[model samples]
Target: CKCPLGFEGINCTDNIDDCSNHTCQFGVCIDKINGYTCKCHSGFIGKFCEITSQLKSSLLQNNRTEILSKTCTPEICSNNGICYEDSLNRVQCRCSPGFIGDRCLMLKSVHANRNDSYMKLSKPKIFPHLNITMIFSTIQNNGILIYFGHMGHIVAELFMGRIRVSHDIGNSPGSVVFSYHTVNDGKIHELQLISIGQNFSLIVDRSYTRFINNRGIRTYMNTSEMDG
Candidate 1:
């Protein structure tokens, strides 16, 4: 019989701990589960702590002036988040998806998923991919969905009802990918984009449009976006 996550045995009496295996490849193993999780000895993501993603050391954000005061109040954290001590001993608020920044206060305009991990684009450190999702509907057919620029730019836009995502790594020429479907329909639609390196994918309502370039994304996608 198939056993539930973390459980195995004829009667499911045994608990399977892959923490020592390739599961926690980049992070430490923590049997505990917590929200605002990304806590340590490493991380435990999602409801069951089933997903073992990369989580490393992080400092307490300066936004929490009161954190060092040795106090944790509900007011400091939003969305019913819980205050927990991260690996660095810095106090952080752990909660549901879509929120980033100190205290998980910045609710992204785009709807996001739980798999969307906490990120600080301000840092030079890059990751394999950046994921974000949102459900929206509008009569307008053109606008920028998201934009990140510094030496160059990574952007996604709704052009004539179709989704287009483009990026340039370092000082190189940019590459782009477009979605297979248009979402100008009256009904609310979901859109998600993952752009990195020389490849990217545009996902609309579960349908996907992907692209690959000789560039082969190598470093962390750059951080920060333009207002207009």
Candidate 2:
């Protein structure tokens, strides 16, 4: 059957969606006759929006010009952001919550008062490798900050002015409370959490860095299978 530039079906009546398989790596995809085009976000370029804007200032420590040979990679996405290739095979970043930017290096602040609101994902997620960073403040001395996982879960909370983390890799869940600085001073504090395999470490910046250079906390169940 004879079909137009962007028409399909046995009788050439169905309009073909060229954009279905052509997604912009950093911006929007617009469909055209038998093809698609990309509208890259600020600081990106390429036929499929795969290049980073940093290329414009390619300079060495001595201010020598550098050259480009490839597009962005998994390392390009910072702040626990994940890099991916889009439908058109261009580079893109999957940022964590409270983050934005082409490389996910910027923080998007969220202000919450007493019982303001909470967010629940409509789907479950997996985290073979994870890093989460945030800044928060509270007048209360105890509460949960973040909770994630399914069969194996992890929870970070404020335990009596200290940072506590509860985790379960595959077995029973266990917890560890940071014994350093206090954080419930009604002022903002920075929190960074990282997990490699079954090991985990954290840093709570409240006039001090806690738990980062120290030991990691492992999660396990007690004789009564209770959260510690």
Best by TM-score: 2
Q: 37-67 in candidate 2: lDDT tens per residue?
A: 9888897666766555553343322142223
Please give the CA lDDT of all the candidate structures: 0.55, 0.62
Worst 10 residues of 1 by lDDT: 32-41
RMSD of 1: 19.7
TM-score, one value per model: 0.41, 0.42
Those runs of model 2 whose alpha carbons end farther than 4 Å from true positions after fitting are 1-107, 113-116, 121-127, 206-228
Q: How does candidate 2 fare on TM-score?
A: 0.42
Candidate 2 worst ten-residue window by lDDT:
60-69
Candidate 1 regions with alpha-carbon error over 4 angstroms:
1-125, 214-228
For model 1, state the Cα shift of residue 73 in Å: 36
